[model samples]
Target: MVRQELVARQLAEQITEHFFHGNGAAEARPLRVLDVGCGQATQVVRLARAGHLVTGLDPDPVTLGAAQGAIGAEPQQVQQRISLLTGEGGDCGRWFGPGTFDVVLCHGVLMYMPEAEPMLASLARVLAPGGMLSVVVRNGDALAMRPGCAGDWGGAIEAFGTDRYTNRLGLPTRADRLEPLTRTLSEIVVPLRRWYGVRVFTDQTPDHVGPPVDGRQLAQLLDAEERAGRTDPYRAVAALLHLVGTRPG
Candidate 1:
């Protein structure tokens, strides 16, 4: 889960800075955030602790139950700042009116979707004017990287022609290319703001491999990873893409 934590920390820092550090009306602190498919409410708890009002929605009752348990373990004030619901990504409009949230997060959930445009439209519909939308998805452009690095020549060869692949969980899943998604966001009125690569070099690592035990080494590794995530040609082939969009006010 080290990689997941890294992604979360980076995203949280960016969101906090974008929403809390500016004086303009667009930069509002203590904003309302919606986390779609918020498994276990990891980001929900973090944002709530930072004083943002956060709501987490997940389709799985068990996941929502666990998220509720996590919230219960926090201080009463933090717990009170969060609300949970059992729902799907497309249910955004059904549960909240337009302009309900300043930040809408839909991370690590798009890979399971058969199609992303419809869901993106729904997510955009509920976002407040000038709000930010964050999405994380498998990188279709680099589907061959992992297999190629692992010496699965056949798999690598096949990946080059397809955006479909089996996930770490052994389930068939889809990926998204940066260019196509950028256009899709533009068409939906939430033009791309900024994006970064995630797990650029660690994509092929075994899931059991985690952070180093030494603090210094772990810190240095994370620094390198963060740098590579934002740097040029290196980021282009990352296993995952983190894209942010802004809705015009």
Candidate 2:
């Protein structure tokens, strides 16, 4: 939960800065947002509560039910602003017309797809002109960091030449390299805008360990992580990448 919270908070900050902060039209209007593969709907509810018109889709009924339950806790108006559906990420274009959403989120979803281009193409189809598309994926360039730091030299060594890695769930999964993904985004007509690394130093930290209880210490830790995520050399070796792209007309 702590790690997830960190990622969510960073995403919110970037979205605010890049999409809602300086844009005059977006500032005056409620942006239309879509969250593909929105597991548990925590972030979806957060965005809806912030007054965006949000639609979240996930293939799992249990997760969609959990999201619905979360949305139910909000005020009626906020709940009305949210829509949840049982669907996969690849069906986004089929579910919505082109240029339907101003901001599209597909965090933690691409890693599961053996081939990501189809889903990327679908996501691009739904984004409006100048719309933002935020993606979060396991970083292929730094795939060996966790295992190498944990002293799994062999596993870390093997990770260097391939994008395949076993996740904490012990399942075979894929990672995305920044350069290749940047190219794909361009090909899809959504070029990369800004990106940050997630879990730069904390990736090797045990999940059992929680964030600092003291306010000052917690702030300090978060501050350091946030800085490392944006700075060079540090971000170059993070465990995950948070990328933002914009569709240019």
Candidate 3:
């Protein structure tokens, strides 16, 4: 809940800030959005509900089916706003023409790729001029923070020398440092516009655990997380990073 809610909030802010500044009416028209690797389509449905034309693509049919199921459960209006494709991010260009999307979301997907640059290049190629590229990646620079927080001194020590880690699900995954990814985005012609930290202090929460049921407590926790995510030094040490870029017009 924290991760998804924060992401949606930040995205709304950025979209309004960058695209709807003139008349204070940013929602004048629906934006063309693509969610690459939209697992279960949490963001896909959310964005569609916010009045955007959304296309969801996932390599796994099972995941696509899951996303379809979620979309089907929405009102007919929202259901009409989304389309699903079965494919991978690297194949984005192969499927869509250049400048096909106004907003492209590649969240929680890059960490699984062996090389982030090529995959980014592929996604960027489909972005229209002035299009937004939103990405979420594991914070390689702060890799030690998680293990250190858990009192695993040895694991923390091991994290410092590498950008690789085994995820909670026991799958080997990759992390990206801020500098390298920033450079890659520029190289791909989608220079980074903004970035925010995610799960800055709530990373230690076990996956099975749910957010506080108490409304006030949950709001306070989200407040702190949002503040820390946007603020300095704290964001630098966050568990995950959310980066937004724009292709030059």
Candidate 4:
């Protein structure tokens, strides 16, 4: 969905702000970033273009090949800033030195893992002290939003109660709430912020709404959603949860 992608971009920008603004940190020191399970490496490429050294790690060779191809197609300056590696998220410590990166990202990858704790622990291990860790996951609570909006209240309730939903591809997927996610990471790092992403209003919109929407309007909607995501009454309906954490300095 366009809205979901917009929301992800908004959250990624927020994570960048948290790293650059809140910490008064220089982008040049320990400037390296790792994008765990970075299929196609879009975020990795974007960060590299912004002058940060980026490494995209994925277990799939096919995906890594695609990421390399994408990077090679970019301008030389941007291409020079990124490297793609084949590796599992939980095995990052073996390939990357501990405390080697200033920012670590594991987005849209954890839901597929049978266990999140080990992967999250590896992420924390690679993060430099005072560095940031950004995570994006499917929202457990939002399982009801689609069904209810589609006029199937009973199905929505049942889905929420069952704690899973089917994607457009008809694959069964699981969601996670903020509480448990925070708790799991807190065991290894300190959480800085928790926010809802792709809030209910945006998630329920059908893909065929119209022609491509204006970026300015999309930005405006994202700004509003970002503000609302941190508060009650709205956070509960978000389709994704974005959490930012930091390794103790």
lDDT of 1 by residue, 1-249 (tens): 656666776676667566665353346468899999999998899889878899999999999999999899999999989999889989898999999999999998888999889999999999988888999999999999999999999999999968899999899999999999999999989999888889986776788777788999888877887888889998899899999888988
For candidate 2, write residues 1-249 as lDDT tens digits: 555666777767767776667454346467899999888888888788777899999999998888888888889999999988899889886799999999999998998999778999999998999898989999999988888999999988998989999888778899999999999999999999888898998887676778879999888888888889889999989898988998876
Task: For residues 34-102, write the lDDT of model 4, one tens digit per residue.
Answer: 999888887888778777799899999998988898898899999888888888889987988889998
- After superposing candidate 2 on the true structure, give the runs of residues whose Cα lies further than 4 Å from its correct spot: 21-28
Clash numbers, per candidate: 0, 0, 0, 0
The Cα local distance difference test for each model comes to 0.87, 0.86, 0.92, 0.76
Which lDDT tens digits does candidate 3 get at residues 50-96? 88899999999998888889899999999999999999999987899
Of 2 and 3, the candidate ahead on lDDT is 3
How much is the lDDT of residue 86 in candidate 4? 85
Worst 10 residues of 1 by lDDT: 20-29
Model 1 ranges off by over 4 Å: 22-28
Q: Which candidate comes out best when scored by TM-score?
A: 3
Q: For model 3, where is the 10-residue window of minimal lDDT?
A: 20-29
Choose 2 or 3, whichever is better by TM-score: 3
Candidates 3 and 4 compared: the better one by TM-score is 3
Screening candidate 2 with a backbone cut-off below 3 angstroms (N, C-alpha, C), the clashing residue pairs are: none
Q: Among these predicted structures, which one has the highest lDDT?
A: 3
Counting only residues 3 or more apart in sequence or on different chains, how many pairs clash (N, Cα, C under 3 Å) in candidate 3?
0
Report lDDT (Cα) of residue 239, candidate 3: 88
